[model samples]
Target chain A: MALPLVIDIAIGQLRRRKRQSIVSIMGVALGVGFFIAVASLMQGFQQYFVSQVIDIAPHIVIKDEFRTPAVQPAVAAFAEGAVAVRGVKPRDEIRGIRDARGKLAALEAVPGLAAAPTLRGPVILRYGARDHSVALVGVEPERERRVTNIEKDMIAGRLEDLRATANGVILGIGAADRLGAGVGDIITAVSPRGVAVTMKVVGLFSTGLTALDQGEGYALLKTVQILQQRPNVVNSIRIRLADITQAEPLARVIEARFGYRTESWEETNSNILSLFIIQNAIMYSVTGAILLVAAFGIYNIISTVVHEKTRDIAILKSLGFTEGDIARIFSVQGFVVGAIGAALGCLLGWALIEMLAAIRFDFNNPVLRGQRGFIMSRSALPFIFAGGFALVSASAASILPARRAARLNPVDIVRGAA
Target chain B: MSAPPLLEARGVTRILPGEGFGAPPVRLVEDIDLTVGAGEFVAITGPSGSGKSSLLYLLGLLDRPSAGAVLIDGEDTGALSAPALARLRLARLGFVFQFHFLLPEFTTLENVMIPMRRLGRHPQDEIRERARAILASLGLQDAERKLPEQLSGGMRQRVAVARALANDPEIVLADEPTGNLDTRNAATVFDVFARIVGEHGRSVIVVTHDLDLAARAGRRVHLVDGRIVSDGPHSPVVPQAVA
Candidate 1:
């Protein structure tokens, strides 16, 4: 019945002490504001990194070889027993998908997926008097574009131009610069078996990764097979899925069916993902300390109010106000301050993110030279988390002072009789 | 033949712990019994340390009796829970202290409205209306909106009285309500108490050291050494009621 009055008295007391209340509120606001801003920035950076990796590479890569080598026939024959096969070296084997056409046909049954087969081998490019060793990659242009971002990264000619010229090749921009080669320039591609073939450079691309830019030379699938002395064989197939998050499960299924090694983007980046988890832990603890300090500020102000208003408490008790009512009055004050602080802090955090995101910062590293800016996540979770933390801290800070106010004895307080 | 008393104290006692080790606890009020009927003006008078104020506190339910019970309108108060006792105090008893303990943060009208709000017997508008009426009747209409610090000593004391009568309790227990007032202010406060009993039909139990003021009551209970030395009606009604 008197709940409103109890809350009203609590608010009235805080209003009377305007400066003290404002100070405590600002403390909470600072804590929440920093928490939101920092958490959003960290999440934004993580998302930016993951998206870059996802956009450049296939979600799942299927290779013709297994991660672990197969045991010898003698070891396999001794099934449950340890077989000592001394002085037996593992066989030097040629690696390729055993039945490429059959596997490709079977993969078509998988829905919402794109797969492209590639034959990769080592080659040396010779232009004039200078020669450089590079990985010679053979890809079907139309199918490769669907599985990777190679088409979007082209700087000069088109990938479709490779199909027009039977013996055409594409050099990375860095490789082209090193060889002084241009579009339509004829270059000698020396095979590992010393069989040399002349091919015209039809295109060039740059992906901002120095290792890829300086080490890869692309050519037609038939051209690479003829040069590497391997006929009708693909070493790997790259796959793209409609949902990137489903890559691990889909890769497992594909590996199980094909008896080949498969790798998902998640498996490849597990180390970096675990690092992000640690970053979040550190971020929360640092931000949590700020909120704890703010709670102490609230505790200080409420303690002072309880001490100063001892007479008012006694008078209210004599007027038949219960102990619970007195405690509620002080708790209400803490809650109001926390709520107001969290609201203002959210606005402040949003503004901070916007301001930081507007300033551009250029990364000058040679491997990944690009324009970088403070990325701010637009998700609502950080704001909710900060507000909840503030409320809990504020409530905890109020308990002791409220209890002290409730425990006052009215008889000793009324007439100063004691 | 008459109606039972509105408040009764049967053999109530209170003991305070002594200061030194192994010292016995000092008794503030002994096995004393008293009753206050409706519309009765009674005064408890004695010298300093005679347990007069202690006895008033015990009867008012502000303090619990160590050995006996206090009954309000025939209900044994000892059996009630703490909250129930508080509710009984809110709906049935009022208290006036030596100092005008009006909440300094609130205006005079709000001070009077505190009890009514706690009791929750009326809506916001009605509470405001009754609070204003009480202040107006006490001749503090112009001062109703003023804070306690802004009012004179007598005006503040009157505000305290108005607050005491907020819930229209059956008994008003006053512990030296005029102890801090000057002679003129003391007389004015006594007049208000006299009217509360005479016109409103509410009982008033005051503890005082002023014999002149104590002599004006219909009955007097004098305490000495934690025991009632004399308890009875004063013969030949003194026509010295303040108003």
Candidate 2:
């Protein structure tokens, strides 16, 4: 039979059972809509969290530590024997990156890579008898700007001012408020090694992270080395790559070259990234359950249609419709319903996303500090996936019923009718 | 009998499988031999449960015979696949039942167009025109757009007749087509069958219980308990009815 005629017959039958058809279509629409909406919301928050993590820190950090302890000279000498060695007194060596300048120059030669050396130590800030303990990080202003977003986060003064002002420091706004200090205020920073330096605060900044805002400050690398009693020694090298996705591999390459412990941003935040996986699992399962329920509705309607159209099926067979033709007729019905439902579902999902975007929350948790409303990814992937899922499910749900209809015996029905 | 018969059934038998667990099967038709030539009208008449409809079904290829073979245009149909048989039916056969069996959702015209569309030998416009011509010949031109539910019983049966003739089949097999109609409608349906044979020169095999209608056909086959007892031409009770 011609396909148009088959489609005409199928559509006429669906029109005859309009209410049931509408109900089944609505079920699929709801499934697809919820799938898209939930996917958008979850992926939006995950992407936001990932961007925050990437922007707030270096893509790769090489610290002055070995991934494994150095082999003792006795163990190295007895390579073949299972020798038991007790703990021996370790050599007293200053823990700092050796030849930091040469390593930085080599890293700077690589394309699309930026590197900066920094030294960090615990210090006590004292102003007018008020004491606040903070981690003092030393940075070269020009190199630091290329490796981190600290310069962008400054609210008051430029980081370059640290080079112009002698013994200058930059404090986070939260830390400065605790010291009752502002730009140009002189504060005494007493290092753990009993070296005290009075420095002028050159800038104040805020990164919206509670830990960084309340407990960290930055100063010139020379001044920090002087206060810590370790002049010209830097302990950490921060790196930024043009492509953030290349961090883990580049970290491995750098670690192999320098023999230092390297941490990629993904490795630094692996716990949170694993939680995103669990979140995705929950999202897919919940949406898949909805689609499964919707598929049941399609099955129910098509099965009933097969039962009710038994006589028509017999008549069609007698009129020379092949089993394949009959099957196609009913299968087309399921496909049409799914297609219509998917179309409506995309619209509904877009409306839902818009509604979600308009909703504002007044709570001030640190994790959601700058967000005014829901974050939702407006991308086409969710719609395509949800629509395709519904289409496949709806078509699959119709197969058994179509097969049943095709297998009905015309002779039996005609005889029974007689 | 010079030309080959349009349809032939030789020693055809159909058995209904019994209920589970070794019950005896019932034979719906037994060792029936029949042949229908072009332009001939044959009537099968029998008492209740006499298997007249069963023989008709076997001859129409609507059911598979347990034994023997049914041939159409001298081709043995027993070895053909189901799809091939369906194609044969689409190209050369038509069927009518006691209940008209028109698709209720379709208008009378679309119902008639179904067979022609399935056969797909003609273009769509030609198929529509052919369906219209057939319905108009059956005096159903005014009722072409009406659904089956909106038509009277006789009109519905005539619409079914129009549908059967849509694909221009060589033979039409009808099982008790006028059984549900009144005497006047039955006569009208008989007249339609007469016109199909006389004007179109097509063969029609009808199953009916009405002896008066059976006598009007050129040949009559009487069945008694799944076997034909008599096969011959019948003298019409009303002489004018044969024309």
Q: What CAPRI class is candidate 2?
A: medium
The alpha-carbon lDDT assigned to residue A131 of candidate 1 equals 90
Off by over 4 Å in 1: A1-3, A65-72, A120-136, A165-201, A208-217, A226-229, A362-372, A415-418, B1-4, B16-26, B234-243
What tens-digit string does per-residue lDDT give for candidate 2 at B181-210? 999999998998998899989999999988
- CAPRI grade of model 1: medium
Model 1 — TM-score against the truth?
0.90
| TM-scores of all candidate predictions against the true structure | 0.90, 0.94
Candidate 1 accuracy as lDDT: 0.86
* RMSD after CA superposition, every candidate: 3.9, 3.3
Question: What is the two-chain DockQ of model 1?
Answer: 0.51
- Candidate 2, residues A1-418, lDDT tens digits: the string is 2458889899888988999999999999999999999999999989988888788799999999999999988889998878788888888888899999999999999999999999999999998878999999999999999999998889999999999999999999889999999998999999999999999999999888878988999999999999998888999999999999899999999999999999999998999999999999999999999989988988888899998998899988988889998998889888888888888888899999999999998886677567888899999999999999999999999999999999999988998988
Lowest-lDDT window of 10 residues in candidate 1 chain A? A362-371
* lDDT digits (tens) for residues A1-418 of candidate 1: 2447887788888989999999999999999999999999999878877876788778888888897788778889988888888898666666799888788777766888888888988899999998988898899898888888888778989999999986999888888888888999999999888889999999998877676778888888888988998889899888888889789998999898887999999887889889999999999999999999999998999999999998888878888988899988888888888888888889888988898889776656543346367767888999999999898888878888998999888887874742
